[model samples]
Target: MKTIKILLPIFIYILLVDLSYAQSKQNKKQSLIKPVVEPPIEVERTTPNNPDQYQLRLIMENDAFGGFSDRYYTNGSRLEFHMSAGESNPTRKVFSYWNDLFITPNEKTRYLQGFAVGQEFYTPTNIKKADVSYGDRPYSSRGYFTNSLTTFTEDTSITTELELGMIGPSVGGKSAQINFHNFIGSPTPQGWDTQIPDSYSVALKTDIRKFYHRFFGTQYNVNLGNIQTDVSFGLIFRFGNVDKTPGPGSSALQPGSPILHEDGKGYWYFYVNPGGTLQAYNATIQGQMGSDKAYKSQNRSSAFSNWDSFLNNPTPDVGEKELQYRMLSEDNGKNTLQRYILFNEFLVNGTTNPYNIGLNYLIFNNIFNGAEEIERTTRLFLLSNLSAQWDQIPTNARALAIYSIFRPEGGKLPPIVRYYSYEVLSQFILDPKQRETLLQLLREEAEYRDNKTYIADLKRAVGFIRAGFVSVSNAGFLFGLHYNYQTIDFQAAKGLPQQHQWVGFQLGKVF
Candidate 1:
């Protein structure tokens, strides 16, 4: 009986062990046979023959052309407009738009990538505006006997340009093109006071960088045109399917990216030029006046004394620095010569205009030191930001402001000003409070009579820059404040100025 009991227990134990092993093996087999649920594979979807595939581009330019004729200044300002280095600047506000014609197949070629045709319009809104004779002359009966006279007319015509451009291969993240442009203009009033003539001319236009075939990251463009030598600097923006893939004669962005049209793809935009070409003009008014014979003999006029003071004074008022000169009044009764100052300031202490900056960006890179250097560098890079705004802050105030911020032994800057200095120095500006405080400080600084008007001007300028630079919405949009100096090669020798300097700003977007 005892043996039977022991054997029964042992047999039950063996059966339990076998059953457990079998269950584990079955579970392993089931796991091995099961199918894996991989994360669903995603294929990037592409639109075929999308109506919204067309590409659109708009470029707004502020151009200045300056030059001096032999009839003008001889010695001091002779080489002034060598490029854009001259003091006399004639400015133009121009806007252009172009789109792909959907006809160019999205295929790559050795030279051709895509084709486009567009129109450009420009108006010369200069303060002391002048006229130039158009190169094209219409056949008129009045000119039969005067054919040899070569009478030139004024340049009061509205200018229009038609452009046919072909895109080239992409490099880095941008593409380039060759633009063949035909220009036509509206006729001026039927009078002798005509401005630029309504003439037709063809120009071959290309970016200066095209010489190397490498478009540098597509942020800025330096364009040069033939015949008239129309030089332009511009900003570029892009939207739509940016083709990151590489191929022969390919663009960083896909060709035919749609514009803001019915088949439009994105937001529509319009830009307000921060300051107009009015800022670019300077009036040159000369008048003949009769001086009293007695006064002339006495030579008692303070002009020489004023001149002496200007040369001797270590720091003179803006008006005292030979900035104004006297001329005889038109009225014979008045024995005094009327004094007039050159209209433009060029006032920001020690800075050169755009042409020199372009030619020597490398050398001047590290010229400024410490806080002053930072301020000056920022002023130069944000080209559209008027220098007069920064210039309005006296150097002592700037040094004091800096000392308050970084110097261990100095008084602290007003909390708001202190924060602003840091923010301005670091391009990552954000706080509105700082801006408000800075304005307050500006108001306080403007209290003095000597600087009241200038300080007010500075405040206005700061507010303008704040709206553009500090606003988050404007972050995507590119803003540029540039000084433009373009050399004017006048084919005809007349009273034309050779060198030009224009300080202007541009607002641009890519869509």
Candidate 2:
């Protein structure tokens, strides 16, 4: 045993020596790669305008294409519409439209905006049927109607909103609002799908500015309702005067904003958000399998002991036939699952700031403690970027970094922990010379990893040059190349099951 202990230390020392040597060699090879530098005068910037002003935006996602238009008319009325469609789900389409009419006379002090929206969503697979009785139904539908009126009091720094709405084939009412200098956004307590018929709820919100100093700002938002409760606090900081005007050139720059601006304009804003939420819901099951007690008893005995109790029921009865058909068609029958969840999250974001950073942390827990199992998870993420405004990189060129950690409770083996990724990005007029060098470096890295044994970890990086120019307002034909690298480790099960490394690279955007 003594000899084995001494040998183990020596073995670990030798392994560390080898790892250091390999890392040093890899770093030296990476340093040999050429770096591309661009002039600084090519960066872009944009300005902000009144929130009510009309704006049109088009977005193309990997799976869907969509556009939106928000037009605020001079009459204090607003109209908005958005629609999107996807290729795989061609039969389904999403539609949304809103119209707002000003009720209170528009003045510097107080005003009121009344609005209503109509939205429709369809999913072909939302409903499914099964041949077996007392089986799972897979279909579901979500529908809702909303109407709201908001009142503003400028002199008192107060605003109030009243809302009436409904959800899930049933109509519900929700109302909320915020006060001036008050951190919270809503005052009237909100409720959804409650058992009570046409009940009225109330809420109050207030905030104090300059909680500590000019650089430190604090705001709080809270809601008390029949079914849901929420509280959120935000801390904000502002730096550097930025143009806040509208139009292509007017700059209302706020620090910490995304620094994609036209020439000669910049802004920054920083904020941190901490919030908690609690919600409770009750659901009733009917038809075929019907309620939880009925399903439990039925599941225990394959024989239909209560066939008459379940089938002979009439319309609107606990076990009706048509409702059962609809439930089965929509794939709704399951083990009568009921669940409650509690969660808290912390968020930080830097907007349009030269140096931006964001951190998000969330913890969730299941509340049901009966025969149903509960689950919990904790997640943390960090994102940081340094702008290239001082460097002549592409408008979107920036140094980016991300890190994340996730832990799940009630699981075997220490959570499958992992740490990954670090990258630097730059874009300039496409340069064939730089592109060739990048490809050569990537090939070398691949070869080196392939040649190693006990290669517990590997690092791979790649770069691409894109030349297609899709012009959006003369943003000057977009052209650039991107590089990405990933490193992974794998442990030798016999020696140290924890010691491992794996990394690879592919061409094109890292996504």
Pick the lDDT winner.
Answer: 1
| Candidate 2: stretches off by over 4 Å | 1-159, 169-271, 280-511
Q: What is the overall TM-score of model 1 with all chains considered together?
A: 0.21
Off by over 4 Å in 1: 1-192, 201-204, 208-476, 491-497
Displacement of the residue 362 alpha carbon in candidate 2, Å? 39
**Count of backbone clashes, every candidate in sequence:** 27, 55
**Per-residue alpha-carbon lDDT of candidate 1 for residues 1-511, written as tens digits (9 for 90 to 100):** 1222323344345435534654675467567663674433222112221221112222222222122211111111000000110111111111111112111213220011112222221211111111111111111000000000000011001112222221111110010001111121211212111111122223332321111111111211111221122222322222223222110101111011111121222222222212111111101000001211101111112222233343343454635543332111111111111211121122111332222222122111211101111234544553433333446544543453334323321111133433333333322221355445434543443232111110000000100100111010212232333333333322212223434343333332322
Q: What lDDT score belongs to each candidate, Candidate 1 first?
A: 0.21, 0.20
RMSD of model 1 against the true structure: 30.7
TM-scores across all candidates?
A: 0.21, 0.22
Least accurate stretch of 10 residues (summed lDDT) in model 2? Answer: 249-258
